[model samples]
Target: MIKPLSMIIFGQDAEQRSLTRMQLISGGKVNVVAESSDYAHGLDLVKRYNPDSALLITNGKSEASLDLAKQLAKEHPSTVIVCTGTNCLTETVIKFFRAGASEFLMQPPSQAEMKEVLEKIVAARATADQNKQGEAVIACYSYRGGSGSTTLSVNLAATLAHTFEKPTTIVDLNLQQGTAPIFLGVKPVYSIADVAHNQDRLDAQLLKSFHTPVSDNLYCLASPLKVEEADDVEPSHIELLLSLLRGQFAYVIVDCQHFIDATTVAALQQADTILLVTLLDMASIYTTKRTLEIFHKMGLGDDKVRIVVNRYVKDPDVPLDKVEQVFGHRIHLMLADDYRAALSALNLGSPLVSSQPKSPLVKQYIELAHKITGREATPKKGWKGGFSFFGK
Candidate 1:
């Protein structure tokens, strides 16, 4: 049985607060931990209780409620901020979403509406708890450039999020040429450097707010916006950031830089699984061998580091067996070669799963995610029709 959702109510109307509390309690799915008419006191209650959800009542005219909601969201990222108001204007809903509110409801919401919201929160919590044993950190690295490490990192994270319904984050460690933000089509206001500068005060909640949300379950922590800002980030910052991300997300995917550096080493050390991405060519094979040797020196076993050959063709000049023989390690996975599909997705500023769900490349990514998570694949809705090159 699911436990009742712990909630706190903050509103200026005492009568409205009481009514809301009674309504929630009648459903037997919400336990109102605290309620206050005073915004400051209610905010204090939220911080104290750290409830599952916070319901802010607004009457459209007051900025006080909105301000309280924003503060709660920033300070308590784990808590679901639900904005309830009589004014359901499109602009009002958009404003709350921009303020970081997760859900919105009409004032004195009906029993059915309230129940639906509570169920959504409970379901999300249950999914999170399912993976609470420990977070899995998967770092994608490539010793040679143009091996599609970034592309793999982005799509793999997206597959885990959209297909597997897992909470996942992708960190862009390619500091100088990071294109994660562009791939996800988001203009981030904060970057890894910003988080590093505030590392002393960083917590899971603060770190959660720093990332840009790519979808409901996926987020991206972009590299430094300015080229020189990369210098501000140190190896220790990467370690601290990964630690906090593990606490908040089920899976953390790091797009490591091509060359070995202090920062990349820090990320690799924390990774539970390392995907050494390479292409099916002699150059990539030679680099993979050297990289494997380095991993052995770093005490990362072959079991921990998996080789993934990207842009694989049907009959490569260098056969799979010969490549595996050179590295003395089996190629864990080989993704299909579809340059047009990949380039189209990149140009569209979207993940392959979103832009070309039916593409063989997307299917391979789904298989990769299943291999990582050890979960069975479920068929996605609206995916039985003819294939289209673009999502349009």
Candidate 2:
């Protein structure tokens, strides 16, 4: 049986506040670990219980609701913040949702409607476990520069590791400024340059000597971090090193440089899922089209490559279907427009999944993991990775 989750609710409204808590408790949506009428006092309850879900159930218009959700997302990191009010306005609801409200319930929802929302949260949570168990790998790269490829790679890698609690490793093959270590807060004594210099001695013991552990199950291959030493490493050296690594881990993520070089090709050949990321602009979309054409020309199957549109906003500047028409391929993944929040998470050295799990952008990456691995990823109560079957 699944245990109930911790939840926090904030409001000055009396009746509406109690009603929201009652519904969650009745349906087993949460354990109701903490409850407080005082907004300031609620922060202690939140920190004490460490709820996975929170609701701001104030009576009328209150800017405090908006401020609370933002703080919870920043401070709690893993908590899912939500807002519900009787006098909810369209603009206010939209603003709160944009402020990271996971689910919004209007005043006086029927028991069934409330049930449905809670169920969706539960179902999504259930899949989170299977995603941790399956053969999940997300290889992120770009067709051109400044397309936010490395940003995606760094965050997704850290997300898979810390958010899902899976064993994750990122191989930084960007000979110049391999950004994984910097984003992940890892430091390495040696790199692909050193790995190549001693490929003859590359084994579990030898490889362990050169790598840096970012978290319990997460590791990073810091690039040389200096341009002068990059020329010493070759594509073949990276290929050999990664081939050995693939056998040791469940997911092998390679942040391949934006090049059609021998190294990138070798990594692609070994990759189970390749993310061909591009922005929505004309030039970036054209690069994606060219990549598809080149892949076809090289006799490579399209099944392995996933076209992802990064930094996608619901704007009329370019229809997503038209972008597909240009590439003549459907975009499998469309990351949201939370580039600022995503960057803040990256800048703080914590991945988006941990910093903002319920953010639309994090949800996209979570969904992509489910599709790539063909397993559902719902949020889990205990362990947070590919599958719960491991370590038994």
Candidate 3:
């Protein structure tokens, strides 16, 4: 069950070079049917075909090849890259790896070497697809304070990363009062403050350097501990940051500020779904009402927002119907009361979702995540087709 691999090449001689390269790659059994020649054209091909690998003949001293490789790698992190060039100097080889090349074949490479390189890059593609399938995003936001937004965001991000073998980031955009690092018990050398201060210098490599990895796949960019030491991050800054993050993590969950500031608004717009968390109380309900009204004006519809009743009870002073009636909307999800356990989990820097996946609370979140992703409401149920083997 072998799938045809998509391949792209760099420069004007794309057709001739890529075709010849494809001959070696196909080995007649495997199809190296897809190819692209130049950097701009390669981007279009990669976006359209989603190539498994891009075989680059590194243009003699210029970084045209390296630059193209970096762009493709960022878009399709799983897409392997193989470089063929005489200029495979020590520094240049390091650059290729940094740009996400799986293997580099020097100019006048051997048939055995080419075959070996092709196999390695293709194998990497298979591994990457498997990893991508297992990823999911958990978004943590609140309708009001004291409903435990920070606690939930920190724990939830950690849960996905540590428990599921998925890469996750706990982004603390609370900005002024964010407590993400405090909860995770980590002291990041650079925080969102630095990112804001150095927006012009923000790039893939620098952003990676700023992230404090909480676990193998779990990382965090906590808030600036000092509230005032900041430049007001613009909407563009947030847009660029989140766009970059979509590629880096299986889940990019932010502990969002309750208010719709420039940053929060940007986050909400880009979110796959928004979990509007609240407890069954008057103050929260009132605040939720105001926020929804504001969102309505901005056109963030009901379809995008999921109301989560955190710390809920079967019966409460405020009934679900009455509460919904007040807001003129239905209650979408409910998590049972477990204040002590939630607090303990937050304090210990462990997420209830991971430690207690089957807990009523955890189950509710899992269900919501499934629904948001358009996966089956039933958890084990998967994508429409049965998992593909080789020739789908």
Instruction: Write down the TM-score of every candidate.
Output: 0.65, 0.61, 0.61
Superposition error at 86 for model 3 (Å): 37
Taking the tens digit of each residue's C-alpha lDDT, what string does model 3 give over 1-392?
24345565554465547555655655742445345455655655555434566777765534777887888788766567777787778998998888877788776577788777767766776786455654533456786778877766765565455545567788888878877876665667888777777665565667777788765577888777577863466666666676567666778887898777777887776565567788867789998878778767866677767777778877767778899998777878776787776765556554565444456666655665555443333332111111112212
Give me the overall lDDT of model 2: 0.69
By lDDT, the better pick of 1 and 2 is 1
Clash counts for all predictions: 0, 16, 1
Best by lDDT: 1
Off by over 4 Å in 3: 1-139, 353-360, 373-392
lDDT of 1 at 60: 38
Cα lDDT for residue 318, candidate 3: 79
Q: Cα lDDT for residue 284, model 1?
A: 82
Report the lDDT tens digits of candidate 2 across residue range 1-392: 34345566677766666777788788754656446667655554565444567778756436766777777777765567767776677887787778787877776677987777766666765675365456544567786878888877876676566545667788888888687776665457677677877765555557666777776667877777568887877766765565456545666688878877777776776576778888888798778888889867755567778887888877798988888887877888888888778766656555666656667887777777667655554543332222111121
Residue-level lDDT of model 1, residues 170-242, one tens digit each, is: 9999999898777666677789989878865666677777898877688899999999999999987886687
TM-score of 2: 0.61
The model with the greater TM-score, 1 or 3, is 1
Kindly report which residue stretches of model 2 are placed more than 4 angstroms away from their true locations once superposed: 1-138, 378-392
Candidate 3 lDDT = 0.66
lDDT accuracy of residue 311 in candidate 3? 80
- True lDDT of residue 290, candidate 1: 95
